[model samples]
Structures are given as C-alpha cells and as structure tokens.
Target: MSKHTILGETAIQQLLLDLPDWKVIENKITAEFVFRTFADAIKFINNVATVAEEMNHHPEFCSSYNKVRFSYCTHDVGDKITDSDLKIAKQISELARNLNGKSGY
Candidate 1:
C-alpha cells in the first residue's frame, strides 16, 4: 500500500471545505473555470502544466472553447490520493486564482 491509501472520504471532505475552490471527485479533485477566450484558456492550462510538471504532478484536463476543467491526483502511488494531491490542488487553485484575480473554479 501507499500513503495515499491512508486518506478517506471524511478527511478529503474536510480538506475540500478548507479549499473552497476545489472539489473532490473520488480519488481526484477537480476545478473548472471559463476564460475570456479559447486562447486565454489554453494559455492558462499551459501555465498550470508548467507548475504541475515542476512538482512532478500533472492534471487530467479538458477544454471546450473558453472553459477548462482540471483533475489532479498523484499517479505514481497506485493512482491513490494523498496529501500531495491536496497540496497541489490548493496550490494550483491559488496560482490560477491569483493570475486572473478570481478562483476561476
């Protein structure tokens, strides 16, 4: 087993409450927001990807025109969720919010 296995739904729920802008989705947390244009959304994802890549984490993302949805969970640890997942989730939420002056999520 891995550290991610230690987290349960209740713990995840509390973390989600504290994180306001992110939502827990089973083992993944998702955040979504719409941008001024498709180009803007793509730029935003690229920026987010840079931070995620640096952290050795990545998001499962989808884009439709100006809308973007991102899901994050650590993949190395049996695709299980962990504090690392929540940390990155919060960090991504903060960075994206700061960039646009809104949570966008």
Candidate 2:
C-alpha cells in the first residue's frame, strides 16, 4: 500500500494552519509564488516540477509573467488533499524560500 494517504477534513484543517502560506480551495491545496522576473519564475517552476516528479505527485501549474500558482490534489483519492500533497507542498515552499520567491498577492 502507498504511504501517502488521503487526509481527512480535520487533518486538512490542521495542515492549513501549519502551512500558513498555503490554502485549500476546491479541495486542492494551493499556493501562489511570485518571483522578481519571468525567468526566475520559470526556473523555480522547473525546480518544483523536478521535485514533484520525484515524489510522484504532480501539481497543476499556472504561470503568467513573474507569478506562478500551484494546486496540489490527489485525483485518485477523489481530488482531495493527501499526505503526498502536504509533503510536496512543504518541499516546494522550501525551494521557493531558497529561490527568494515571495508569497501572497
């Protein structure tokens, strides 16, 4: 069995509280990262993609100029947040911090 399991409603709520930069909407845990330039944003996205692939949990990415939005959910688990999503989000958050990315609008 897979180690990454679907998170319950209460666990999801706690995860949101623990990950202040992330929010859940439409059952997906989402975050938007902003970079100083378009190139920087793309580079960060590539880095995130690599990590996601490694984790075997891909995210929905939408990029426009220097802004990128990521939404992570487990389609196999009824499009809900899962442990893998939480792990990948944490990894992405750390990568964004290292790349000098900013959160919020």
Candidate 3:
C-alpha cells in the first residue's frame, strides 16, 4: 500500500474551512450527528460503514441514544489527519445531511 501524507497545518485549516461541521479535536477531525431517534442514528452509522469500506478508511465513533460522535484520522499516517481523513469526513458529512442528522448534537 502507498504511504499517506500528513496534512500540514495550513492545508488542514483550509480543509476545515470547507468542512463547517468538522473540528480538529486532538489529532482527529471530529464531528457529531444528532438524530431524532436511535434508529435514525444507527441507520446513519450503517451508511457511513459502507462508505468507509469503499474508501478503506474507517473512523472511530461513539453513539448514544440519539447522537453519534465521529473522529477521523489516518492511523497509518502516524495518527495524523491526512487527505483520506478529509475525504471520509466529507462523505460522512454528506451522509449525515442525507439522513437528516443535525450537526453539533
């Protein structure tokens, strides 16, 4: 497998500008999704799982009754944010939007 590049601070800042719901928390790009019900939240997570499989990049998430918090970072890239992290973050963001998951839950 090809090595992933670690994103520079400036590039990460620029990417975050476009990703309004995402924030740099620790070493990961993190976001939270709020759903009207637990089932909706789980459905959204299922959608994300498919995307992650396709992209071969998985994220860590914590789910409550009606909320899910996603943390994205490339473990292969020294656990730093990389282009893969940004790409997956965007996809997850879109999935959340389509599932009617509100941000900043």
**Which candidate has the top score in lDDT?**
3
Q: Best candidate per TM-score, number?
A: 3
Ranked candidates, highest lDDT first: 3, 2, 1
After TM-score superposition, what is the CA distance of residue 11 in candidate 1 from its true location, in Å? 1.4
In candidate 3 the C-alpha lDDT for residue 19 amounts to 90
Which pairs of residues collide in candidate 2? none
Which ranges in model 2 have alpha carbons more than 4 Å from their true place?
A: none
Candidate 1: Cα lDDT at 55: 74
What lDDT tens digits, residue by residue, belong to model 2 across residues 1-105?
656698998998897787777998888999999889999899999999899888778899899998999999988777878988998888888888888899954
The lDDT, on a scale of 0 to 1, for candidate 1 is 0.75
Task: Give all candidates' CA lDDT scores.
Answer: 0.75, 0.87, 0.90
Clashing pairs in 1: none
**Model 2: per-residue Cα lDDT at residue 15:** 79
Error of 2 at 19 (Å): 1.3
Model 1, range 1-105, lDDT digits (tens) per residue?
A: 654544678898898897877786766888887777787778788888888888777789988897788887777776666787888777767666655624455
TM-score for candidate 3, residues paired by index? 0.94
